[model samples]
Target: MRAIAPQPLLDLANVSKMFGGVSALSDVSIRIPEGRIVGVIGPNGAGKTTLFNVVTGAFRASSGAVTFADEPITHWPSYRIARAGIARTFQNIRLFASMTVFEHLLVAQPHQGAGIRRFLPARRADPEAWRRAEEALAFFGLAAYRDRIAASLPYGIQRKVEMARALTARPRLLLLDEPVAGMNHDEAAELRTLLRQLQDRGLTILSIEHDMAFVMTLCEMLYVLDFGVLIAEGSPAEIRSNPVVIDAYLGSEA
Candidate 1:
């Protein structure tokens, strides 16, 4: 079978967000093609996370607009955005400590309503969804501990589990917020491999990360934001040589 061509999956146009007297983002426009990974990079306080929050509706943009899959979704609620196939992981891990990993995946299936819910999980449980969930866990090699509580996993595997939960929801656009924040080099490398595997399988990813090596390897296009505005954008190699990006990230002494 022939593979389908990738298309524009998520688009942001002149999106700006503010909190009280602070302007977190200004006139930021970005287009993410399907099946590609785009990196969002910046110095501290560049509003990277703020942009994610705005897109996912954690906070409404004070000005400008946002759209997903061609429809206007500027200020939709978070759950609404999730239902629309926008799944995100936090900069810090957020998982139910006491819940088993399988339970986490099951709950993410959404309300199939009473008719579908009552005898559904018992009667084959939508083989496709189960297959996808199992596939994701197997990809991350977490199938062995499907019944384990989330908090009991090792840190590196915990990252995999969190990512697994996100994939279990089957999002079209996955917003990964520093998937390697607290990880060591080896752990980070593993996460990078998982992300690439996700992209190769036709997932569109927008990630916020500080690890330059990870960013350069995973993303073809890089968007740089500084002090609430996008200062530069280009290919990873170009971004590495960009003066504006250097000024934003490194001091002139370099």
Candidate 2:
């Protein structure tokens, strides 16, 4: 008997991106199933962030297809892609300079409907947005910092606030770029637990991380990219032992 595979929540088919004449991504294909945590690891200049940009419609791929939730979004604009149940955090934390942590979350909920209304400020009277904001705040253990200006918070807490802001959108697919870039051990571990909880609740996550230990322990599958090419992919144990991965990216870390 043959077991059927679950349809992928997100699929990138032979995707490539070009910057003028330079190639940023070259015929890369990957698929992520729903409710799973996947990691992409590579050294600096490996096109990891570029890959993220393409997925989020920050850049249009020169070729290939990006299908999410069974729909092809290859030519969609960034805002349209985001409104279609995908949300992401940048490699560098992006927070509203003068907004409080709670306010940041409140402003991040997905705007419904079309027209000039979408560009207007979020409705302060919307209870559902407020509820989601509070839920994200509590889930991220950010209650104490709720009233503080988001940009003025400590580095680690700012990270939490950014993640919380993303969650308020209630995205089905969450893309994290170097999510644990500046955290201490305990903070990173706490994030691992939090992400697992989100996964258990059926949220799909894809992250690009240089923190090998964090990625190794947290991701169920890993993809290795080097010089804009996907060089390897496998389970954590297999990736650790893969000679090409060690030579190209992991080095002594492997």
Candidate 3:
């Protein structure tokens, strides 16, 4: 008998989004399988960020369905979507400058309560939460910097801090928007290793990146978009040689 394919961890089915009269995403569909790194690439103004926004509920789609782990989340609020096991990092680092690295992770812990209960002082530090934070710090090589203020860290470390904060949420799927942006080759290389480790630990990652080399080398599959439309989808090798993808974004170098 032929084998059946497993359902994707995240599925976008014929999704489209419009801003005023302008279409930001037009009939785009993609699937991210469990335990794999999937990449989305496009030129500037190609709606890559908009696609992320729609998936995370920053904006509602004009048409189509989004399902995560078999649950429909297309119309869910941003916070609701986040609480439903999705976590994301921004294209630009969004760390709390005045907060220490440890504190950032603490705030990301889910189900701490609400209203006055939320404000109730912890009688003592939650040992489990702190342990998780420490593990994340060590994993990202930021344990020594845990007590340091986020703004004081080097740019690459700040990016790691943001990623660490997201991991503290214990998300089922992580969305990274340009996670390697503004990094030197050495920094990017270091991050590449960290990402691979995360995947090995069973985290499902879907990322948007302009760093073609990084995306090509790291992602198992690639999706290319242009002017809000998906133009191509393939393995990295196929993407690297696709004439349409090259003309639209990769240029002659690809």
Q: What are the lDDT figures for the candidates, one per model? A: 0.83, 0.90, 0.89
lDDT of 2 by residue, 1-254 (tens): 53498669999999999999999899999999999999999888889999999999999999999999988999999888888989999999998998999999988875676456555555545667888888888988899988999899889888888888888898999999999888889989999998999999899999999899999999999999888899998899999999999999778554
- Residue 126, candidate 1: C-alpha displacement in angstroms: 5.2
Best by TM-score: 2
Candidate 1 vs candidate 2, TM-score winner: 2
After superposition, candidate 2 runs with Cα above 4 Å error: 1-4, 115-125, 252-254
Best by lDDT: 2
- C-alpha RMSD for every candidate: 4.2, 2.5, 2.5
In model 2, what are the clashing residue pairs, if there are any?
Answer: none
Question: In model 3, which regions exceed 4 Å deviation?
Answer: 1-3, 112-117, 122-126, 252-254
